[model samples]
Target: MIREEVKIISKEYLNKDVLKIRFEKPKEFQYKPGQFINIKFEQEGSFRMRAYSILNTPSEETLDICLKIIPNGLASESFKEAKENDKYTIIGPFGYFQLNENEKEHVFISTGTGVVPFINIIKEFVKKDYKMTLIAGYKKQENIICHEELKKIEQENKNFVYKPTITREEWGGLKGRVQKHLPENLSKKMFYICGLKEFVIETKESLLEKGVNEKYIKVERYN
Candidate 1:
């Protein structure tokens, strides 16, 4: 991959742990919603690269990557200390998790930082006026990143529905794994799910159990 220099335009904590880092790339840098970019970082003996989803929409000039700061991982640790105006090498907007225009209703299910891709997708929906339903789950209430943003989107677009589920907390909304809320009537919609391996597998199973066609389900697994 040809590495390109992208400048860090801003950095903010979406949650206490999840960080959203916006970067400015060349004007022509373009990619689909669910695709990701390979981030290049320094290493002593070998090169270190990590794939992060492009969390910015076409309407936005600057590119962005929503990163979760791991306790001791090299990439996460480096990003934790990365300052504004710093430039880093980013290669490609890879992967095939992007949704198509023909797919009218999107059922996006994600856990933890896996919700990053859907954030971009929902942004596009708002810009182009499409319909989408988001179901995201986390371990606890405070751990839920992008809580306020999701609520705002839900309020802004009538077609946009946000359902936040928690595994360990009692909440007014759905209070279990996201699978518990998978719509029974899914014959006409497309599904995109992103999470860890187990979470993705279980979510796929739940969708299948509810009669969602296998072809309509797309998954992106992280670690």
Candidate 2:
């Protein structure tokens, strides 16, 4: 693992609160699709850090991270004050989430910015023969991130399916929490669930109750 200070390339807002920040990749940095980097920042009179999943594909030249800014959060303050050309100290590309090696369809369930890791993984999986399904939940239709890009990927790739659901607002696509309307044949496919603790726990429990094997499900909590 390498601790390096990298310069911010650019910053963009995916919606009203989500930030998609990119940094110039270090020359020797290497990590898998489902990994994250620990970002170091100065908070108050001391240093603090936050873990943000790598958002871009592994083959990309730059590292990207998408996160929702919780108002007055520790990392949120640093993210809010960040600008292009600012230097960010990053350490490690750490995570244990792995795609199942066996022949099974890939199912991803996530809410808000928890979809970050899957976004990175899907970019790698789409090139393979795996049949992938992504169900992303948001509070409203407008809060959806990577909307056009994911839709384009869905249209172009026959092996991939994208569903963007909403809870607090009416939408043309799917509606409700991720666990409320899960895809069919849950037992046969491998599951990856991410989001707040409740979201992860509820979805995992739902899958377990449906007879999906414990080994077939992987989960990550954002909050």
Candidate 3:
């Protein structure tokens, strides 16, 4: 629980609604991959704090986060006006969503910006001798975030495979929800899931029904 005000070094939109913001890393800040930090800001003239998952490995030079701007949400409204050099208080590198070391193969499943933590986790273990697969779901191609960067990582890393599924739109690749497109070797790999309640609950139930041990499946629910 260290809290410090940090300067935003850069901020840009990865897509129409996703904001990629980078902060000058505080010398005292320490965190593991897949963790999130709370940003303290003003909402309705009062102070409000919200948790955002880190998108880059902690070892990286800067602390980066991708914000999915929900329309009219308190935190979303504050971030919409955010600019470079803005300073905001950040607290903790919280959550226990780090990579599972016991499994040689790891599967990351998510919808929308739920993929944020996986981005950080993957960056940390990308160099290790482990197989990683990402199943990311979105409403349409236009809604896909970090699509090209994940693809490039897949192309360059023999251990990684990126699968993007689109629902409510025409797509030549995987379609429908993430639960429908899970891998075959379910019992062997560690599964990580993040998303809204319905998606996370359904995906967890689906995995349990498929004989994956409940202990091997970890989930973080968000909206």
Candidate 4:
């Protein structure tokens, strides 16, 4: 793997624990919308690495990544303490979670930070005429990240739809797990899902039982 050093351009706390960070894209770096990069930093005389999906489109000059800080996690602590212009080593353009490029209806389902890759995919690949739906699930209202951006995309493209759901809090919008909100007919739609392992397994099983072909569904799971 080729390692490149990138400078942090900016970092902002989106919510209580989630952070949105931007880095200077290396001149030689080339990646697909849904690919991820591994960031390495030194902590206690040792190197710690964590993989995060890129959230910016290829047309953008910078690389963006969103991560939820885990208490006591070396990588999370390092990110939390990062300041602008801080340099770190990055390796990759990894993962196969990308748009299929076929002209077909698409449904994207995600929870928490799992929505990172979809942001780039929609902005970079989904054309205005492409049919797409995003169903995102969060635990509470304050935890809903990137709703404004998603809404902007929805307003700009008539073919795209955004639906956000809350499971642990009362919400005026959709309420319940994303798996329960799956469209009735999956005949012509391709499904892309990302979330916790249990959620992924349950959703995939539900899709399989509903007669959706395995090849038509792509999934990525986080711990």
Q: Quickly count the clashes in candidate 3.
A: 0
- What stretches of model 3 exceed 4 Å from their correct place? none
- How many steric overlaps does candidate 2 have? 0
Candidate 1 residue lDDT tens string, 77-142: 889989999878999878999876787788999999898899988887665656788899899898
Q: Which is superior by lDDT, 1 or 2?
A: 2
TM-score of 1: 0.93
lDDT of 2 at 106: 92
**Model 1: lowest-lDDT 10 consecutive positions:** 122-131
Worst lDDT 10-window in candidate 2:
95-104
Cα deviation of 218 in candidate 2 (Å)?
0.5
Residue 120 in candidate 2, Cα distance off native in Å:
0.8
- Model 4 poorest 10 in a row by lDDT: 123-132
Q: Worst 10-residue stretch by lDDT in candidate 3?
A: 179-188
Root-mean-square deviation per candidate: 1.7, 1.0, 1.0, 1.3
TM-score of each: 0.93, 0.97, 0.97, 0.96
Better of 3 and 4 by lDDT: 3
Predicted structure 2, TM vs. truth: 0.97
User: How does each model score on lDDT?
Assistant: 0.86, 0.89, 0.90, 0.89
Question: Model 2, stretches more than 4 Å misplaced?
Answer: none
